[model samples]
Target: MENRHAPDSLDSIYSIDSLRARHQQLAAQEPRLRIRERALRLGVPEAALVAAGCGVHARPLAGTAQALFRELGTLGPLMALSRNDAAVHERHGRYLDIQADGPVGLVLGPDIDLRLFFNSWKHFYAVSENGRHSLQFFDRSGEAVHKVYRTEHTDGAAWDAYVERFATEAGLPVVAEPPGAPEQAEAPDDAGALRSHWLGLTDTHDFFAMLRHFKVSRLGALRAAGADLAQPVAGDAVEAMLGAAAASGLPIMCFVANRGIVQIHTGPVKRLLRTGPWFNVLDDTFNLHLNTEAVASSWVVNKPTSDGWVTSLELYGADGELIVQFFGERKPGKPELPAWRSLMASLCAQPLAA
Candidate 1:
């Protein structure tokens, strides 16, 4: 199947026509003092100022200053403009307008507000309704960048200070520093805290303890019952045996013998010691095929010795049948038999009426 996921396209929403219109509007509205200050700072002729009420100057540097004027002028107007175009929404208000001639750009905002702009070469300005801030972001070639704003008041300073601290703790670079802010202290190591959190989330100790107990208890019972046959019976037989065991309130573990060709259900009981890879004396294996529908089944258990070890055997037979079932737990291992074996033997040797 073909993959259905694909990303959308990237395109600018602010067009050249919109930028040129805003540029003209700002050029007409510049103040004389503002133009003179900007011209002096940029080493440009005052007569060339667009907002100075002098019109475009004829001086040799007039072209350069006018270029700078247009560049700086675009910033204020662009910041005030808004658009609800589809391309504008695609960027969520962040889109770049690439111009063929001068370096003019426009950035949109979430409210469709024109948020920022840049010009051909000199000066970078940002506008907000509260006020406007100007900074020299570039030289004649637009190379150098500088910080445009900083807070001097108590609240702004404190907020900036906290931001710096947060950045340090988060392992990120601090971009802005507050006035009179103290040097950042090294963040403390969190390795131990992280490890503790992981332990709290996992709580592996209790889980492992339960698992180990289950393994040990089940293995011990299987060994006592002598149901160590390495075969597995059909899925249905195992389910039947498990159901019967559950109904009887007996603790038992069932395992497959002969790699699932047969199953052996083993448990411990006081009488009728039994073990099995349960099979009839003549059949060689308990024939599950004989009674395909019989749901009731039986398994034999043996008594425990004085030493607490049970010599258990299991025999699975069709319910209400006299035929001999399978035998298990025939021999002892490296350990010698304890009194518990005798008790189990006595119990196993008892007679039952089939």
Candidate 2:
């Protein structure tokens, strides 16, 4: 069911040109196969596959991240997509209020909310298939950072202008070295100091700095601070959380992030569907696919904000990676919703799954 060819072995047999030709042939017949999965099977980066189909199927884009993002707003209606290995998040809207400073960028809009880190974003392309066009960006590892696809309401004239402005010569994408293993951070021995900083946190943005100072992972920090600051919750609480949110019509926020980008969904989710190891939220404008099996631990973390005490449900993977997060939908100058907070408290009281 899966291709088992090693990268080196495939390289020894097929030249780059032949591989590209073969990819095209396969792609034509198996249009449903996702390019990312196809690339993994071929032992190549996903961007490489898309790049191999340049000229006829795709075009290269050349420019700085800031310059390119600023132009995206002109594209009118588009679909923004971001996904990790276990989950995918997609939103259909316009990219607005784009601000880029140094290596970071933010899309602060009612729809299409994203926080982007551009340091690893090195390759860009405009891909066309089956009459659909999308601007795709990738990190050094050839992993997708973000993608924007033109919708029926999108401005065709603006799309053409953007393509004409950034088009480049057709060629294969440049590959980067594989990502190195993350540095092992040992937890601080001073539990009191760690708890002091944790309890003193006034903003969620400061959480990362606290982790850096304690030299610990998020779960480690939660453990060091004990149950009062960060309480251990049953992993199955996610299902209950989603169900309650849908039943009560409670507006909430869901955050999913990869290495180079984080995507957010606000408002309410109505549909909750499950299939095997996957749990899905299939709404009209939003879709979330989460692998429940990959979640190793879940915690309910609270932080003091100017508005009040904000709470969150954070899920972690086996390797200490943050998988996804959930919170009550709230904006600046507003506190979290009372209904959502009540639901979390009730869910937290439930016994752990055996």
Candidate 3:
């Protein structure tokens, strides 16, 4: 199988080593008691306070809940006298509120950062002080979802126990192995380290590769429509292009330049072809006939006419530079398309990108 991973270059901006070092440094600077105190001051329950500091399953809540809190919790009274603060109740508040009603999940720290791994069907809510500390609640998604809180006296031990129970009940992936007895060290695997490094770098490469996939897919779709000359085209082609675009981190609507004039060939256009000129089904904007000159410029025509119309398409950016090309008809059985499919599959494994 082709290796479809994001680029390793992203590590420079979001490096695991750097993140780990920062987390450790911050942990060292702030005492456990202080962290617990801050959490409590924000009206967090004792359980949450313990979990945030030293619990095995301690994880940052994500999705709509996080976005909602980031937009509103800070502007409220929750952070009136705390150290940590969030900016809420801004113009963007409505957007966050809408998303909060959608599907979302939490992501843990550096160990599992960027991973959209969720433990349960839960929503995390928050209440902030006057720009100080923030209190968060994790609950089920419902109109009457109950709120749970953590207190100041909540210690690491209590948090750890709760995490263990939660993980056991939910069957979620464990973030780390349980702490061993004092003076004992966990064995390191040299092979595992090497594998991890390669995999991590591959993820970075895949990120950029997705952009290429989008370019190729768009070219293919347009070519299948005969350079917009063919009035109607298969919906499957559009679907394929949109799917590829999504994998590349682009919006679905971005592919459509003009909606009202767009002619979608719902099925096989080849079957509907006649020995005549191409006609526009809508607006009659352009001739239905294919322009041999434009086709020659965009594609290389070398194959026999009896094999059906096949052309190579080269894509250019706004600066008139070549991005990628789609050669010939896009056969569903072709192996070349797998590279794009693999890239998409890896992206799917990630919690839909933030």
Candidate 4:
């Protein structure tokens, strides 16, 4: 697929009216132009572009994370999409079993699992285009956090009612605020202490807290853990791992997220396609678009679970942000798959050619 590049600056600069006109014009000229890519090319955030259509194809929506999920459940089956700069994760399912605890929320459905960070979701839009329907949410930087789109199987009547109940007449387009300066995490004071903590991880859920306790970046902790725990892998490890999973019929869990929600795909990825900078999984009910070039580093990370040692392939963007993660599919009482471990070990052993 071809992606359009943005000029140095938007010719007319930004205003809700001007952006809306240009967005429509471009959409007409290049029907395949992706809004997110166009935003980057124009040096604007994606949320701003969507917001510019406030009174046109988009309507503002009111709700917190919890409220939105409750309302969305009524819409029946739909496609939930969440993405970052490097990856796009799409899954189709109903929104069920949603629970909110403070700033965090969970959608624990079988197919549409998500982890939501409400604090970052600052804007929402109920959008309609070419007979398609969707609700999109954005973060402070005008970056999309999550989106739900109506499918043919969805209840059209319920969707219309949901929008009518929540949609607001747009007045002014939302503006993206400046991204805050990144907080610098200090390096671990003692490598031994850090490695000891790493080795003591009883659950992968505790990994984040452990990183915060040590005040170190994920990569920093891995580096300090020495070769035995976190092993550096080739940058193409993602592709290799996916291929292995497909060949081995290993059901795996793939995670891709942005600031708002972590969207997961759990199953075998049968088809892998490489087109330009994108690496894709084109499968029924699930699709993944990954910008392989943006993957700066990959690691084979092992964590001890009560079931046994769990292995994962973690890919990071250039800025040290995690782009995506891959893990063998397993439940609480189940041990990690031997086939998955062997694949990871093989990938680790074969370093990329210099």
What's the lDDT for all of these models?
Answer: 0.26, 0.80, 0.26, 0.80
- For candidate 3, the 10 contiguous residues with the lowest summed lDDT are 82-91
Model 4 per-residue lDDT tens digits across residues 100-178: 7578888889989999888877888888877788998888767788989999999999999988888777623555565
Steric overlap count per candidate: 28, 0, 37, 1
Model 2 poorest ten-residue lDDT run: 1-10
Residue 8 lDDT in candidate 4: 42
Q: For candidate 1, report its TM-score.
A: 0.14
The estimated TM-scores of all candidates read 0.14, 0.89, 0.19, 0.90
lDDT of 1: 0.26
Candidate 2 clash figure, as a count: 0
Ranking by TM-score: 4, 2, 3, 1
Model 1: residues with Cα > 4 Å off, grouped in runs: 1-32, 35-105, 110-112, 115-119, 124-354
Q: Where does the lowest 10-residue lDDT sum fall in candidate 4?
A: 1-10
Model 4 TM-score, 2 decimals: 0.90
lDDT by residue (tens digit), candidate 3, 321-345? 2222333223333322334333333
Relative to the true structure, candidate 2 reaches a TM of 0.89
Tens-place lDDT per residue, model 1, 1-354, is 111111121111122243234434554565433433443333332222222222231111123222333333222221111111000010011112312233433322221112223332332222121233222232222222221222222134433332232221111111111123222212213434422332332221232242243332222222222322111234243334334333544443222221001122233221221123321111111112222233233333333322223323232333222121222322333222343233223333243111
